[model samples]
Target: MSAPGGNWGFRTGVNDFWGEDHGRKTIGKTILVTGGTGFIGGAALRALADSEPGTNIRVLSRQPLPESLRTGEVLHVHGDLTDPSSLRGVCEGVSTVLHLASHVGRDPELCDVVNRHGTTALLADARRHGVSRVAYMSTTAVYGHGVHRGLTETGVNPLPVSPASRSRLFAEQAVRGFGGIVLRPHLVYGVGDVWFIPTLLRLLNRVPSWIQDGAARVSVVCVDMLGEVLSGLTRIPWRGGETYHVSHPRSTSFRSIVRTVCSTLRLDLPSRSLPVAEHREISRGMMPELTDHQHELLASDHWYDSSRIWRKVRQCPGPGFSSRFARAADWYRDLLPIG
Candidate 1:
């Protein structure tokens, strides 16, 4: 049973968790954040620190703490998810847990070991330590191979096409069994991102041919926004099986997004066209990292309905599509490293 206002207790369907005061009520709570050094995890750390200054934050990292994280009252713990013994004392006295670490490589075997088995280990340890609430970060790619318009949470059982997604789904099953909240978000982009924007920038220079004429409508969310929603989730109480989709209400078409980003970067858009099979062949030769499933993601219309999460947080609407892309273009070209 879900308690009301306890460590894991949160009111359902209430958007006032973080009011005009910016979630000041969240102060003084202890939260252990895994993957705190990664792109989305780092954003969540900053958002939590900024919103609830008094909140005690613990970050789990396998490597030494980065210089930037050492400035504040953040506690950095050295550990690896694959090594359960390394996780000692990390969950002690923590009221909440955010599991964001995952193996994002192309190997299905490794993906299961890290994403599935690793999560299983962490959840077991957290439960043992009396952690009240846990939030698992998931991907929209879980719903694989579908032309979705406004897919709702629990809308479709994930038909994961890739090993990464399959493993994530497996992890989701574990989280659900453990009574933790699951957040499934689509392509997240922001300042620290090295893949999404940089890859697109590189693609603009080569590959004369494109897929589906770049007309797929894709759903994407800003990293900071996703962080805020996640922060809110930690405080709000919910039933053990609650799941939510995270994304902006508006959907941006692939063609328009690419054209706008290219224009901002002062790069030329791919004007040439090719059949789907031929386009896949060229991408495979050039960008071997993109798997067959990824190619389909680029070519198909995939988006989600995020009204369930949106109603729970009072966030200022972001800028328009063109302006958002323009800002990201500048950041990708200058601030973010591309190679």
Candidate 2:
């Protein structure tokens, strides 16, 4: 969300995806969205199109978009974050920058280059172009994995573990230093998500079990709704550089997610259960990809206080995981059908 003077037109829909627009401060404003080809980015593209009519949208990408991803009236500009020179002109005429582009990989250098240095370069370009506001999509993983519950945005220190999270922590600082807003979502799941669910299935594929019933409470949000939120943030009259936890207030348990996945996707996973010690040993021996940090994420609580953001938009949290996940079930079914 933008700072106090920027009036963001936002309200929750009573019977729709995300409607009830009170006032759209972004009308006729050219909004630039980066990483518009990735999982959550895809959803944001559509959501922005639906939510804010008459707003000029510029999607920055290194490669041309495929035919299927082409949204109406979205001007695709050829740009790469890694190449700082390429970003020189992308921010021209861009009133607001929704910075969702990030690097998520094991390569520390790539992460730093894209997430930290790239963001700094982007912010510099935006400043030169007189871009008024910027919003960043950071991850709660910056706090690392532990039993975090009901944590506020300003209360905790970020002890990042992975190269990705560490780099993003620095990215957040750059965004904050520029008087921009930051949103930290724990687990985002829904259509086009090739990471969260598939990763879980990978762990289960190697060892079909849970660590002590897998009751780790995690905050989850559907991509569709998240897209809508990001669009609003571009125009919302928010507190400057104020961080918010963007998630449903209700925490969904890991065991419940597994059960839902099995039932919805008809997967015969979790056929057996294991204790924490055995699970770690087997994962270490067979599936080394399942790092200890990943295991800790699945075996503990990570929920944040997201009421502030919901209130900012004058909306209540949408449906819980069961109902919300059902909205995108068909897409997932087609993508990961395994009856």
Candidate 3:
């Protein structure tokens, strides 16, 4: 689905949706966004370009991206997160840094290098340059497995299930010491999402419906909302070493998500539910390295309390929450038949 209001046009009135003046004048500082070519990072870059023009925006990446992804006079810096020396000049003259670059997924060593080592390196450099503030993009997966009915920011019951999650938790601690704001977004989804949606669709195509009990609840946030939160981070005064959970206020059922995907793609919905235990056993055998915590995440419920975030930055007051979900589903539909 395309962005509403047609043609992905740039928005000028910052106050039109959220009733907040996030105009260029309010943004009095330069910003640097790592992983700006990625989905969520790209969204944040676009929002900043529209709302905070004239603010020096730099994107840190190892390689060049398409011209279309480059929004509004963005300066691209060629650097790898694994190399600390390369990040020296990247953070120079930048007042704020949004750390979104990390190695996610199955590779343990790579995750350690990018998520743990890379974060530490960046934080050190930011401190050296005396950057005013920083926002580190973390995942709710750090909480790890089981029902999180009303998970809050203070909660730190991280299950060391996957290498990625473990490394992120470690990185969070390091970032906290550097006076960095850590944002833990649950299940971020949107257009240009090559990770979450494609993986879910593949699982849907391969597995039976009952494997996850069809009742698990998961918290989620649209990329647009996440972008707003990231941008707001630079303005708000963050409590040193504090973490904030970023998610849509409501928790949606796993079954509902599957149904939504099927409905959007005009595909047949799965009718049978497989026994949870049996599915777990099969999955473990197939993916032996997959941590038990990660496996448990499939059938687990992780609902976050986003009240603090809402109080800090007003959500875009447009349609109801369902409208956001529909937008995500529409985006998913447009990128179909992927290999």
Candidate 4:
């Protein structure tokens, strides 16, 4: 659950979750963002507002957001993806639908209702409204278990172990039928990531580094870079129903990432590596719901190949990707409130 006062319990003194300028052109186009109030969704909306001034941008949020939180140029529509009928008007006059809404958890039923059923409903509405294109935000977890080194968009499903991953994969298949684009981004980290980065920090405090195979290389991309890529999808003409793995050119080692966090906080890095067998035993003992697929992720590498996406979109042409980690550290240090 979210923290009290609408805060996501983010660490005090971090300033890493703001939007950047992408300089996109939105002439005569109306775009809809499903999860505009969310971290990545908010960033996408801000980028669009900055790049294309005066464009008709609409956000479908469950709760009404304060004016200061919005782009001022955006139209806020109160709606829920769980109810397909509520999404009808939300898709009206929207030529491009960026479906970023999703539910992440261990509950398979809840995951299906939101990720699978919600996506199905959204696509139906988009098709009904005659939307020209769509960009569906998905996770690399859909690829599932084992060492996913150099995995590409077209690679075989390694193994979907978690309820979240299975539901997401099902959602991907459902959306693909509509001829829309699906992007699986791995380890999306940025300032406003209350779940991803903060969760890692918490796990670091609780668990030993050996569980994740300290040297395992994992692919990651900054939320900002993902936003830019989302914007590119709108501008670039591509075949519908294609899946792209969005990530930075290089991968980060599990140990190095943890060490970075420890160094940033002036804390000592964990030296003990939990043996694979012991790690599994401990995980099952603690999180009995831990699926076989999720276990594979912790013990093995889950990297991806982004050559196809890079070849088409061209390199981001700036330091947007590399600067994200440092920016995250800065955000955690500056914007987060101190006790």
Candidate 5:
């Protein structure tokens, strides 16, 4: 399925979709959400708005926000991460800041500029404006490739394979000193997700092979659930530089995920197998649009241990592994053009 425009509000009635109230506790502070227009940040903002009606939110975005999300409590500010001067008043009166904007590209220099230097500039502004707390949405890709089982927060982060991941690691280093929590979520998917699942579906349309026949075990999280985790963070007693891995404790096989996706979409799975090198070369020739890093992700495992964060959030896995994705499958499918 192709990615749709960013219009994911409560229209789909998935706000309380997980069968939980999602914590009605109020933060009562003005919060600034960078990348609020994106998937994770947008979901987190909606969850926060539902849970805390009185709380005010400031959004920094380069695009026009959907009319459905621009309520009185939600304020929009124009800014770009590449332009530090444009971020002049974004942190004014904001007690908490959620750093969600980062470059997800192939260029090393641009990635560092936006992900590393951009974060550095934002945190500096937050500190200067007396922002009390901050939260960073880092990725599990920082841990690198291979069969990672039950990986911890302080677990050795191997050299990143993608330029985006490497830049995020540098950003995490800057955020470590910013006096708040860092959440590293793996394979976050749901409505409005343009990365994890949608990208795979698009690639699978062209490539007809899987690495190791897609038997690798991996960890994943629902975007709404990740948003819930972000919303609940303000209420928790977290120390500065404390990092947490975010995902279900259980891991699902990569083959099962692909099968479920195909079944849900009424599409057929690839019937042939090829060596990793041949498949990579063929896929690159077939779809020159996708980055090499994105292609590598489908072949690796990124399972992590989320027991500690799960206990603190006081939330259980919403439904069985397959059922959760099945429930949202239609939403993703709708984003694709009907063939």
Candidate 6:
């Protein structure tokens, strides 16, 4: 997870994050950023701004942006995704669009309204405005839960079960139909995370046990790298809609995830390891948010081969999870405040 001020490796300029030079393609361009104040959006917004200091940026949000994002360089556009009328002229004079806003909850109608219908309206507006390029943020959960290991972008068929995932899949389909790019990242963690870290902490707080000691290996990315990857996408010469899995080259064991979280927050580790069957019997329905399928997913392999994104952005995935986790210990401790 990447906090706003964490080390995102943008010292020299935005081009430095990409490692190689592409004439700084984003320079002086009019780019619009949706969901610019959310967790991932905030990180990506910061990186995009730092990449090209003088570029014109339009941030769309239903609520007011934080003081941190209120720099004079950015043009805040007040709009709501749920209301298509508000997005009528939002994309005008914009060269690039970064779609990051979505409804992530159990409400199916809300998800359909915000994630699916909202995106369709935005894309329609983008096409009418003659926007040059568009990029969308998606999740690997669109593939559903399984023993997925080292799967390519198109290796597995998308079988989303959750309301949020299903609506996002529809949004992805709309983006591809408009010939825009889609980026999927699995288990993104760092400073601004409110899902992965908080949910895991809740699970551990109630029950300090895992099925088979969390041996399942999963692919993950830090928020800083993820933001840079999203900002770096505008520079790629992509056409006709392409999907890429965005994560580190390496994978981490679930055991290591629990170990690191516990160590970082000074929490107790699982004292007993139970078989999957027994664990299900005891853990099921304990948390209304987590289901039996999610429990199984937590214990299975979810490694996705994301080397393509690393190559696309030309940015190093940096060190492994253990090292990266240490760097964000302070942020996690301050947020989670559990032991």
Best by lDDT, which number? 6
Candidate 3 weakest ten by summed lDDT: 1-10
Order by TM-score, highest first: 6, 2, 1, 5, 3, 4
RMSD each, Å: 6.0, 6.5, 7.2, 8.6, 7.2, 6.1
lDDT of 1 by residue, 76-148 (tens): 7777777666665566667678888887777888888778877877787677666647888989888888678
lDDT of 6: 0.78
Q: Using lDDT, rank the candidates from best to worst.
A: 6, 2, 5, 1, 3, 4
Write candidate 2's Cα lDDT for 216-285 as tens digits. 7988888887888887675565556778899888998889888888777777857677888788988897
User: Model 6: what TM-score?
Assistant: 0.90
Give the winner by TM-score: 6
Candidate 3, residue 151: the lDDT equals 81
Better candidate number, 3 or 6, judged by lDDT: 6
| Model 6 lowest lDDT segment of ten | 1-10
Per-residue accuracy of model 3 over 226-288 as CA lDDT, tens digit each: 887787665555566778888887788878777776776787787887777876776665555
- Measured with C-alpha atoms, the lDDT of residue 328 in candidate 5 is 82
- What's the number of clashes in each of the models? 3, 4, 4, 17, 0, 5
Clashing pairs in 1: 9-237, 10-236, 10-237
Quote the lDDT for 3 in model 1: 6
Per-residue lDDT of candidate 4, residues 1-339 (tens digit)? 010001111111101111132333323566778877787787787677766676667777777766755665777776776666666645655667788878777888888888888788778777766664778888888766567889877778536767777887887887778888888888887867775566555555555456645777788788777777776655555667889888886877877776676677665677777877777777665556555555565556778887688776765524433345777887655533322
Tell me the lDDT of candidate 1.
0.73
Comparing 2 and 5 on TM-score, the stronger one: 2
Please state the error at residue 89 of candidate 2 in Å. Answer: 2.1
Q: What is the TM-score of each candidate against the true structure?
A: 0.86, 0.89, 0.84, 0.83, 0.85, 0.90
* Cα distance off (Å), candidate 4, residue 88: 1.3
lDDT of 1 at 31: 77
Over 1-339, each residue of candidate 5 has an lDDT whose tens digit, in order, gives: 001011112121112211244444333466678888888888889888887787777787776677977899987877778777767656766656788877787899889878887787788777766664788988988876565767888777557888898989888877887776788988888888777787777777778667678876778888888888887775454567878898878888878888888888888898887776787888888878766656666776668898888888787767645888876887878867421
